[model samples]
Target: MDTRNITYFMAVFDHLHFTKAAEHLGISQPTLSQQIRLLEAELGMPLFDRIGKKVVATEAGSLLYQYGMKMLQAERDAKSAMKELLSEKRGTVRLAVLPSDLDFQLVPLFVEFKTHYPEINLKAFSTIFVREEVLSHKVDLGIGLRGPADKRLVQVPLGSEPYELFVHSDSELAKKSEVTLEELTQHALVMYPKGYLGRDLVDDVCKKHGFELDTVMEVGSASSLLQLVEAGIGATIQPRGLLKQHSTWPNIVSIPISGPAPIRHLELTYYANRFVSKAHKQLSEWLIDFFKARTS
Candidate 1:
């Protein structure tokens, strides 16, 4: 079986349209159709059912699609392993992290990592969809909240941190050592927009408590949200580590959330079967140790 034909078949299966799949594959529709027919003939069975304008994968095609993904991933891993044999220190480690952590926490660690392993190219970016990015193979590793069970991913526990109320020193709420979820709703708050993982986690806790946070502002940027709290515009709820790492902003004080605090359990996730180059392994170990030190 030709991997090229399997690739074409997967494209068509994903799109469910011959022309669209062909366009995505950068091939002519007729050429893609012919390739599919060849693949079907080789398998001795029809791979797809074309009814009117619809295209649906047959049972055999569906089973093959699952294995096809693994086969392609294996091919990629083989190529990567061969390339790494030349030099273990010279490679790229792509990472995706939460926006809040990226903005306020990880810069120093990243700088330290780069200083030691300057030869290893590090491509790290902030995103809300950390799990999705890792699963799609867009990044070699991801740092985010704990994700649901998936056999393809191996999630190493990073650490758990509680979300605390942040406010300027002059704010009345800052005088209190702690605040309950109900009391938190009474005060004006600034938070991440809906659909963000952080915001969704906080919102879920609020819903369980039978009240919603009265957010006066919804800022997508973590820095901006902290800025608002620093300026006394509105208080915000975030991981305690955010303010702890950045002591430059002395005015912002973090107050613990009493009565079922919203805790964010973080993990370092990567594909279970993906090749782990030396550079990748080093970075992963460093990240795990970094979090452990912080929590300790």
Candidate 2:
């Protein structure tokens, strides 16, 4: 079937009204009606049911609508990707990331990437569920904690960032150069909401060490968690890089996790067989060296 027919069907499905769909498509109502009739005749079945003035999809129409959406999206994406290839100079890479890693991981890496490919547009969204966006193919790449189930995504473990306990300088724990999970659990815990990698790591450590964390409060972002810890609300454990910018906060202390330090492996994930533009490949290579330099 022609893509224009698919586009017309999608336009109708979206608006569910003949006149509105035609208006959106910049075509006259009768032309849109004729196209729909032709599509139905081609399929040998009526696609929509006219109930008074309202339009509703028939059984075949619903199925066609589903496939039509996918086809049109794929077409648009293919055109966009091809345009980027033809240009050979610039393109956009959509990226989704967890909020906690925004400043330390994403922002710096984006800046470094833009320095080389200044024309490459990076569209980034900071949220907890970047994986979903990647899964839906809405974003070209993702940076976040790995999920439980394996799929088609290719994940490259960049490096694991260790977690550190934060305490106010005047607090007794601040006197120590390093603090263990056991020691940290002795105080009230300020933490992230459940399902966060850092919070889960802290919980796992506390469980293994035969103690339950005294979680006094939970916040959404790492920055806010650090702010709460600095205010002496309670101590919290977070990735080491989170401490970099907040290093100068007065009365703030970062104590390394003792024993087997729980580390969250940062990964660069993308579709296994999906197209990787020149800019994307360069950014990926840069990340490899970037993390290596930091770890080294």
Looking at candidate 1, the ten consecutive residues that score lowest on lDDT are 287-296
Over 1-296, each residue of candidate 1 has an lDDT whose tens digit, in order, gives 87788889989988999999999999999999999999989989998999999998999889888788877777777877887887666667899999887876778878888887788889998998899889877789999888788898999988888888999999999899899878976788999999988898899998997888889999888899988998888999988777766777889998998997789888999999889988788789988987766655
Superpose all Cα atoms of candidate 1 onto the true structure and report the RMSD in Å to 1 decimal: 2.7
Candidate with maximal lDDT? 1
Writing each residue's lDDT as its tens digit, candidate 2 over 1-296 gives 89998889878987899999999999999999999999999999999999999999899999998678567657756776897867855778887777777744556678878887787888887766777777657688787775665567888777777888788787888778787777665788888888876778878866886876778999888778777878889888887766664445767778887775677777778766566778878877876676545444
Best by TM-score: 1
In order of appearance, the predictions have TM-scores of 0.86, 0.72
Candidate 1 stretches with Cα past 4 Å from truth are: 51-54, 112-121, 125-138, 147-152
